[model samples]
Target: MIHVAQITLETKGPRLLFLRKEDPVRFTWYEDLVQEEKETEVFSTTALEAIRLAYLYWKNYSFKTLNCGFRYTLPERDEHGNNALFHQMIASYSSMNGIYFDEDLGHNCFVNFASDEAKNLWKNLQSQKRL
Candidate 1:
């Protein structure tokens, strides 16, 4: 049986906190998701502008940005052997939901779990025994 971890988010003011639970009291937290309320609020204004420009490159394009939290693994020497396998399992399941790996960003190695569509997709795929 494949066991996948869960992603939880806590929004405090404009900063978003990401968490992953393991043991009862052990929770790993890292990274922050800041709401881009204004153009200046974005960390990389230039990058954001570039993305917006590229997004508009396609005609009649409708971009839907969803808040799908991310799941992170510990930085360990044997991460590839242990964590990678587990992460892959989670990511595979996440892909069934609308969540995906943000390869364009530095978060390429991490799994992003967000989107109810992805959750439904994963459920359907599981029912079909394709996953």
Candidate 2:
């Protein structure tokens, strides 16, 4: 089986074992009612790494952003200004879903982990307008 983990405060819950169980509304947004198939995140091995990837993904949140709409645009501050969009989106979509172990999809057996404090930290950072 592929062992994967996510760093989130919600370590012990149904989410720990299930994918796309965070927000039913959001999940349904991308699901096909006829097929009953829902969209889910590709987790990583570390929470921070996962959040970092999410941040980059949010930075380039656009149509055809990437495979499955996940992009990895680095958050860099140039003469223009800080790249706050990525941080903002990450915070907005913060959800500390936990680890997962899947027997299928051997190649993606392991992905980066998401921080336990990703949701909270992102919320706080957003509140402070740090992003």
Candidate 3:
């Protein structure tokens, strides 16, 4: 089954830490690891809680709005063979909003605001595909 693996956001400093559905002790361990690896303070509790909430909602529901004016919608079906529908939906919305989606990272996907460069890349990529 599809799962919400991670949520990444662009910030002024280092990326915020958001744990998934791990126990408190494990989560703390992950936080410590991030601190050691990144050498940056990661806000785990609040950010992780937020990501958990968003993930739960997305798992049960279809769509959600991010802090920015961006909205994320999950695909309806879980068929492994076809991602065309999902890609098409993302492409249409991304084009309209000037946003671009990154390659799927495990269970979660990443999207960023489409600047001129991103738009051109997305357009070029889309032109060669059916969906």
Candidate 4:
């Protein structure tokens, strides 16, 4: 399972903290993330709760945004005999006048997840809506 520790969002985008559940020892720590990402915020929790909590806060200020989008990791394997880190992302923009045009950006993309549970966790996050 992927343990979501913290989530930080700025004018740029959202940053999520996660740790490989079963392989904490060999969990390769990646540096090069932004300054807001801190090791001190590790909550050792799941993605659902983290996302739910974030939605509560983001919705308060993101009033102009009427639509939400998400990316989900796929479970299929690639030709290398390894789990393919494919992902899907979709977007639906709503206008104040009620007109809308959607985009399925997930058409061609690859993603990396800590584990299979991370994929399931992302699906749960997608089910939640604030607007």
Q: Highest lDDT, which number?
A: 1
Error of 4 at 45 (Å): 2.6
**Cα shift from native, residue 30, model 3 (Å):** 29
Per-residue lDDT tens digits of candidate 3, residues 9-120? 3443222222332344333112213323232222234434544454554343332322221223334323332222223334435565533453442232323332343345
Ranked by TM-score, the better of candidates 2 and 4 is 4
Candidate 1 structure lDDT: 0.35
Clashes of 2: 15
Q: Clashes per prediction?
A: 4, 15, 0, 1
TM-score of 4: 0.23
- Candidate 2 residue-wise lDDT, 89-115, digit = tens: 352244243112222212211113234
Q: By lDDT, is 2 or 3 better?
A: 3
lDDT of each: 0.35, 0.29, 0.33, 0.32
Model 2, TM vs. native: 0.19
Taking all chains together, each candidate's TM-score versus the true structure is 0.26, 0.19, 0.19, 0.23
Which run of 10 residues does model 4 get worst, by summed lDDT?
85-94
Report the number of the highest-TM-score candidate: 1
Tell me how far the alpha carbon of residue 102 in candidate 2 is from the true structure, in angstroms, after superposition: 26
* Minimal lDDT window, size 10, model 1: 36-45
